[model samples]
Target: MALQDRPNEKPEASPADLVSSLAEASLALARAASEGEAYAALDMAAHRLAALSSGRVSICELGMSPNGRALILWQSSRGGLSIGEDSLFAEWYTRASRMGGEMTPARGHIWYGLLSADTLNDETGIRVAIFLKFDEMKEELAAHAYGLADIAAAVALRIRKQKAAALERRRFDGMYETTRAWLELGADIVWEASPEGILRCRRILNRRGDISRLVDGMDLRSLRIGGGGQSLLDFLEQQGSVRHMRAHLPEDAQGRMSTGETLYVSATARRSPDEDAPYIGTFTAIGRDAPSDGTRETATMLLQMRGARIREEQHRREAEAMLQGLRLLLSQDSSREKMSRLVGLVGECIGSSDACVAEKGLDGKVRILVPQQKSPGPGAAAALDFIAAGAPRGVVGVYDIDAAEGRNIADAFGLEGCQVAALALPLRGDAAFLVCVTRRAEGFAPADLDFADRFALLLRQALLLREEQSHLAQTAKMAALGQMSASIAHELRQPLNTISLAVQNLEFLLESLDFDREAAAKKTKRVLAQVERASDVIDRMRRFGRKSVGEHASLVLRNVIENVEAIMHHVLLRAGVRLEVEISPDVTAYADQLQLEQVIGNLLQNAVDAISGIGAKHERAEGLIKITASPSPDEKGMTVLRVEDSGPGFRPEIAERVLEPFFTTKSAEHGTGLGLAICDAIIRESGGRIEIGNHAAGGFVQIVLPRQPA
Candidate 1:
């Protein structure tokens, strides 16, 4: 090798100089390696290389042996036509082949090969690649190439490490700053209290950040810990331990803790202390102290659920109390003693002053059995009392005691102040009765009302039963009166008729005597006819008012019209009226025979009265009374008795009230008011109907009775 071919060697270069130059280059490369740069950094390399190789650029790359690639090989390239294998690619390849290693056949001088983005040595941040050469001498390539590659990898690794270090510092600082702010705001504070049922307190912070005394005491997300507070020592109860005493405490949205006292902190989560993966934290804090924000959120959710359960429990208690009252009212019995006990029990249930019961009395006045309230009407003197009475008026009613002036009725009744709300129930018997209650301020809820209503219903049914019983007793009285009147009328009829015959005989015997005798005989005959008419009326009343035969029985009504006709005949004749009867002998009913005759007779009598009224007072007709009986067309073989009269006809109200007992427009002496009542009872007992209305011809009273079984 000619030294002159080395081209542009340093003018004063020497071996000593070369050592110094190499040393400089080595230092620069080392510096560049630390800074992480490659390839183009060789420009700096070349400047240093000039000290050794002068103007000639010498390069090296990895090489291969004759057998093929080897783990360690070297190659070099000479610039400016200074090599036997002159092409930069080929010459470098050959030089590498000559090294103590093997190389690939590409034979390139350029030191380039496939390189991976992944650092081949993660710890070193070094990326690995096959070392090929371009324009480099074969012999020394591996040595120089590796040195360059290693230096470059070192620089990249250093840069990556520096960046990571800066980021870690920032994150650590962030955690600390945020936690400090939270603590300053008193949003969170670590709590340390002993488990001795004692209240000793302290703020805690460990190596890993954790804070407590917050809205969510042990919650992770809500924990405002300094940078890294969670540590194992926290698990040993070095700070504080949970008290065994259990209690409910309000918690925030995180379910951790709230400002409310008396809350227990039991569960927890923490952050991992590993700095490399800073996102992780250690979770040493249990109840009052927890680190992670996520844990706080979860705790809050649980607290909300607990709160809902508590509310449900409270409602259940209220509902249960109300149901108990209702059950008590429904189970009691119905006598006054039983009733009194019931009212008292209910009053206690509702916390009331008094429960009073009153029944409307027989004389059309209200009476008080319980408490004995005095006097029937409003003029009565009493305190704290209520009244109930039967009237000619309408159905049931309710009145407020407070509105009644000055008498202190409310005070006496325990219903005066705010402590008094009262309810009165009308009894549902023959006549109405009342049950009044004056309650305390809590008043009565619907539950109370419902209970009272049920009790009232019971009393109502009982009262109605008693009334029915009394009505039954009255039936016998009615029957007795009817029988007495009928017998009197029957007895009176024969005597009166006998008297009339005697009077007629006397009139015949006295006709030629003085005018005074004729007048006396005529007047006597008139009196006899009046007596007969009165007797007939008595017969109808007696029969109509007779008591019911409770047992079902048969009756014969073929004689009803005949008997009724006899009663009416004298009246019709006196009134100058014509009476006719058209009825089947076979006509009968499942009725008391006397009752049937009364009904028939009453109809005939009513017709007679109407007809007599027409020509005399409201005057128009020479009246006719027609009685007819036949099988009713629509019934299953039933019978109908009809009495038609020529008269001014019937009034609406009169016809309406005709069947009501003790109701009549006639004078007291003239009627017991039982005529139509008795008639109705007779026909109704036979499962039949009695109707009075104006006929197309004039006035009418028709009775339709069911036929008796053959």
Candidate 2:
């Protein structure tokens, strides 16, 4: 995938021919004792082909350009004629195919085509050609080639083995040696499985890879993950491996495994292959506060020297360069803030003043459209409008400014200007809309287009994360504030109730000494109840604010809601609000009890506030508040709780902002503005959501809670 190494453009050799050639060559090298032996065998093989061709056949070398054709080099056994090197194989075939006689091999079994002319040097004025043809007996020549290949393979294997032996001798000093030894000791990679049988790895080895005592011949580089004899039995079972599954013989039952679809996983579970335990070296990977901090610091001090510092700086530069390369990878970035920074740079990256994006609409049209650019040329402007008007393939695609002609600019495309070129990039698949890169003067370059396309992808994915992070931060803050406010409210209730009661007692103390002690005691009890009610209100708020989660179970939701109402009845009465409860029978849901309680309390409190804010304006028509709960008909398993107050209805515009944290119509003293937001979060966590708006009764806020299957 390097820029220069574009595999897409690389012409693939015929699979049959490639396999045949590689197999034959591998066999030869494997059989040879050394490189010299392999070369000698190749020369002898080439000589045999020459004798078989009657000295007319040739071959091609790999990666030799003008090297576009099949590469098969030649070795003449006997011929007065010679072929020039400048001729390519494709040209030879083309010419050969056109010729009257077909390509026929001579006396040998080897089958090969002539290397033909590809170029004529302009300066030298020299033309290259291959006039050779396949002789009658080609099979003999093939046999000769195959024989040489076999010898070559032997030579290659011997040399490779010798080198590997030298390196394998040092295995005792390295982890690989440790792994190798363990595998030899009849070990299997150990892993732990969940009760559900999901196996997470504790180690990997023994099940696959080279377990043979002959260390010199093993493939060390491929000894891990897909290779290195890494046998993923389960991974293979789940995700079929095209490599070894079909290639290896005898279908090693010992290597039976499974795989994961999205994440490639090893299938076989670890077992005691023998009585002995698997040997694992006991060396700890130190954490940040390791006891060897002193030595580490001393090492760090040493690292600060010129050699280490220079290396560190070099590494830092490399990382910075990589960041620059990935500057447009807004999607891969984990942070929305980082994504936002990338967003700011997006315009500059695309050479546009303003660049906003739109996502694909559900109707397969373009919506949520964004135009990025302050003032673009007519083309850019038209481009933006065209895409904005028409649907795009996805969140991102090519938007030719030429398409938008003779259209009213500003009125049509939200805002428009001179448009030169524009490109639309869809974010997050085609889920949303396209980002229009409206540029002025210059059109987008190829690199610019490619960059914008990828950037748009990254940007879209990042947006979702950004949105989630933003929501979490807001939720956490609101939860904290809600708890504090609730606690403070609870603490103040008793004192207020005490003061109210003392005033009542004083008012009566001035009366007759026997001023109906029984009635007086009842009045004092009511005052204490109100104080307790205040304490209850505080407790409810604290419940709403608490970070701890309650155990979940299916419960009769009606009871939970009734309990909440009972707890807050005093507070509701003090505000002069009438509470109404309407819950259908047989209503049940799986949810955390305390959390549901908090959810119900928040809704009730919101109703009281809305009523108080509106009802206080006039003494009359202070309406009733209704709370209802029932199973959702459309959703197979869901419960809906609706709390409605009969006060002035909510304005449609504020409805959307109602659930946002720190958004309240009332002054700071009366409300923390965290109530609805916390309610939304708590509900969502319990698998639900809350909505605010005008009710049929007068005003309403609906809370939707998800119910787990009963």
Candidate 3:
């Protein structure tokens, strides 16, 4: 990093050579890396010059004295020279007394010569003093005194330049370093912008660097919103000259504006003699402060308020988005898969890149439901084991997992080593939902955790809904079995009777001496066919009887209707009615398969009973029930399912009541009245609606369900 040392050289002989040597010495001093090296070069030059003149040369600093004629040797080539302070003055007087123009001291006698400058005086006070013996060419040496003066002057100049450069460097470094320190201690931004709002320079002095660019262009609107209190634009426009103006700057998060920080700033429009220049300003940040005075207290309070407002705004937005996502989750059936994606979405809303949901089971096992990513390494097992132990049960909160207490949980989040914050939602009993989000430790403030708490509330609500739906689904399955019991018995009896008769016939054939092979074969085949029919009946009964697993998926209305018709065929036949199903191939919807079938079957059963009850009162009229499904009238994202029966229509006043729970018109033994009500709930919860009315020839029930999205 420093220049290489100058080439070393030997002393010269002639006066001309000595002058050249002095020039070369000056160049070597210039090449010196530091002041110490330069001094060494000067000493070397003195020694070389002493050798050339057959005299010892020394550099001296002239000192202030009473007589003003003293020399102090700073560096010497001759070590033992003792020249008295008055000796030089005595010599000068002797020369004057003799009246000689010039004279060198005699040989073998010690005398001193000074390197005197005619033009440049040494501001540094150093002079080159040469101690020598008298020589014949004394005037010659004195005649060329200017050359020695020039050499001394060159050394002085080099030293002076080096000192000046070092001083300038120190000054520059000190000023900028002090400025930087002050900025870090609470100076937010140093910015300069054009009067027309174009930014010329912008610097952020805080860890929150992303927001710096928000004010780069210095737009009046951004300033007004980002800085809340006084109208920044109006102030800037009205100011003839502004300095250290206190103003409000509001925070902007993805275009959602709210109150931000109060900043002390100097904004000035530079003015020359001829024209006004662009505005230059700085927004000084106010950091954490403990004030000893009222003024300081007020300033600190303002800064705290600024930070609080920004956090409150950000948390509100995140909470709202989180609640919306949870609503969407609960709107459908909540599943582990959907919940996983939802956790990630929630993380993004709250400015976290990593998030997950975990469940603690009764068997001391922790299940990560959402973000079922790769398992953690062995290093994380200890933390995960603690969670599985259910130590945090019922201790619900938004916690900084990176802190002392939360470290274990944070460590278990896997992969990303960012700061973690967790929200735990306790379900019934020992089961709990633990949701975690991760970011830099400072990224989340205490107030920011409020959003996580809101998220926990949403998760709790979703869990409650899921439990309620499960209970409702089980209750619906029970109600369906009670309603269809009699029909199921009647439906299975015929096949059972056929199997018994076929077995008796086969036995009779086998008892014959020469068994009628063809007859026995026919009877065996008949019996096998009957057994198969019985199995089918049992399978359909089991499908409708078991609990519904509330999972939503795409299903074609035509296919679902065919399955329902097959299951309910005997029920319709025993009711003395004909069931006709007409469904378009393209009528599809997103719904639970078993639940949808149950709804349609309930509707049809209600229709069958209504037709039978009506027939008992009216003269024997042919009973016909028609179930139809097609796309909605206007082709919205919906499928309309209609069930119409040739029965006494609903009493006009009771049309709406028929859809209400426990409002069936049928006899108590035959109806629980939950059929239509359950169907209505299913339709509405699927983001659709249900309608009940009297059509041209029957009581009609119409269902509109959300169609599968393209």
Candidate 4:
């Protein structure tokens, strides 16, 4: 090829030389390791091409300055074209306002072409300009110059890719180091294990001391849970993965177990996707050696706080479960039966075998209420007496039975030949009740003692509630009787009038001159019947007014309804309210007969009051009270008794509060409001519920009770 500056000069050597030089240059460019090395390779290639064509070559880096002017960053020294503080290239750049494409020759035999434009900058323009000085210009020389430019462009792209990859590699290395440091700070040991539970590698991060020396190749099956149970391998196989699992290592050569040193460890492991792949996990010591640095110390503190929170939550759940069991037992059992079972429940909670409730009489004699036929041993009896008489009420006391004072109690209780511990909690009352529990092993923990105290407190509350309910029931019954006073007198007057009339008729018969014996006999029979009728009314009132002794039995629903109706019949009549009963004769309910009657009567009275209240506001209002009993539709094996009244229904806002004590919408002089509250208490004690709402007809009160004893 001929040079553009020297057109008369023959092509350097031949086309064969051009191919050899281009191949060598391409290989050098491929071997370049960095952007600087790549540009050096290009510069060498430009020099070789210039030599082959008998011309001088200059490679200069051009870019737009911050002020929007083209400037030269660097240039080769072999070419005649000079780019300095004041150069021909700068003058040409100023005229053209650009730095790309071929530029016209400024002097003889000098040509310029863009080798690579904007190769480094997309936002700002940059270019590599090749300046060639040849003897003459020719089409062949121009082809060589453009070919070399294309090769340089390819090399520039390679350099850009290399720079990007190096930057990414540096970022990744920094991140990896940071993550490794954090892991080391957070854990005492990081480990990897085989699929078969063999430790492959373990890295200890603790700087102060190392408690675990179990090295690689150890079997996980050899390690047990800290408190003693299944092996670590067994746990891993069952659970597949574990987070913060605490385990104890085997005894070291020094004959020290994890527990003896008070060492606890938390482990977290994850299973790999492939079953045969290794597992990766960490082990952190809990409540042992302190960390060596502030960052690790903070991390350890966070872990301990989290563990404490989890343990607290677990304890709360256990307490709730125990309370629920206590509620169920109290609701279903009688007083005597409940006391016995309650002792048993306390014993189970405290892990004790012998437990009982002792009650002190006014004479200061302590007697066992639970385990009826069993009496406390002499020493135990003495302790119970002391507790009941002088021990602080509602406080749980623990004693080491192995001690001098407790040994006698233990021996007296027939708990010899073993360590024994006792816990006593006194319930509040004049006749104090003491709960006693004895364990044959170690002493009770603080948690166990706390649970026992809570149990005793709940038992006391239940007893108090029962006593209050009984008093309220009696009070409400007397109130009902008071309300029926006027009606009862009126009821008795009619029968008395009939008997008097019959006597008068008999006397008239006897005084007559023609006395008829049959008429006299008939009048005497009428008097006798009236007397019996009045007696029946008084007997019904006596039964209704009496206190209930919470004895549950399956009573015929119809019979119970009849008893209530008889008691409330005159009251309903006085209120001008109609009473309607709709109960199947075969339907039976398990509840205290007197209490059931009280509940029914109270509901009847409320209905009458509601209807009468409406009557006072509107004249001649038809008062209708209906009582219906049937099997409950929503609850299986339960009986439902509904009492509905034709009156204004309960207001939406106050409906839920109606059953609360002393919450009444009636005038204070008329309603003490214990009526519904007592009824609710009685029904609940019978393991039943009462619902009060407005039905389609009007206001309704429904009682649901078990058909059989629970």
Top lDDT: which candidate number? 4
Q: How would you encode candidate 3's per-residue C-alpha lDDT over 1-710 as one tens digit per residue?
A: 10112223344368777767666866776577665666666666665555455544444433322233344545443322334445443333222212211222421234544544422332333444444332333455444333544555556656666776687567656755655444433445566665566654456654435445555665643454223455555566666445555544454533532234444555656554443336666665343353212132334545665576566557546755664454445332234333544565556556776766665555555555455444443434455444445436444344455565466566565635455655556667435455455567565655446555666666666555545655676687677677677877877788889988989888887888988889888888888898898899889878877765445577998899988888888778777898887887877887878888888888887788778873235443788998888887743677888899888877755764666677766666776677677776665545455666777787788887767622
RMSD of 2: 36.7
* Winning candidate number (TM-score): 3
Q: Judge candidate 2 against the unseen true structure and give its global Cα lDDT, from 0 to 1.
A: 0.46
Off by over 4 Å in 4: 1-345, 352-457, 509-516, 614-620
Give, for candidate 4, the lowest lDDT window spanning 10 residues. Answer: 1-10
lDDT of 3 at 348: 58
Give the per-residue lDDT digits (tens) of candidate 1, residues 306-335.
Answer: 565456544443344334323322321212
**What TM-score would candidate 2 get against the native?**
0.29
Report the C-alpha lDDT of model 2 over 109-149, residue by residue, as the tens digit.
23334222211111111122223344454454545444443
Each candidate: what lDDT? 0.45, 0.46, 0.58, 0.64
Clashes found in each candidate (C-alpha, N, C closer than 3 A): 74, 92, 9, 9
C-alpha positional error of residue 674 in candidate 3 after TM-score superposition, expressed in Å: 2.3
In candidate 4, position 500 carries an lDDT of 91
Which RMSD does model 3 reach against the true structure? 40.1
Residue runs of model 2 more than 4 Å from their true location after superposition: 1-546, 614-620
**How much does each candidate deviate from the true structure in C-alpha RMSD?**
47.7, 36.7, 40.1, 36.9
Cα lDDT, model 2, residue 102: 29
Question: lDDT value for candidate 4?
Answer: 0.64
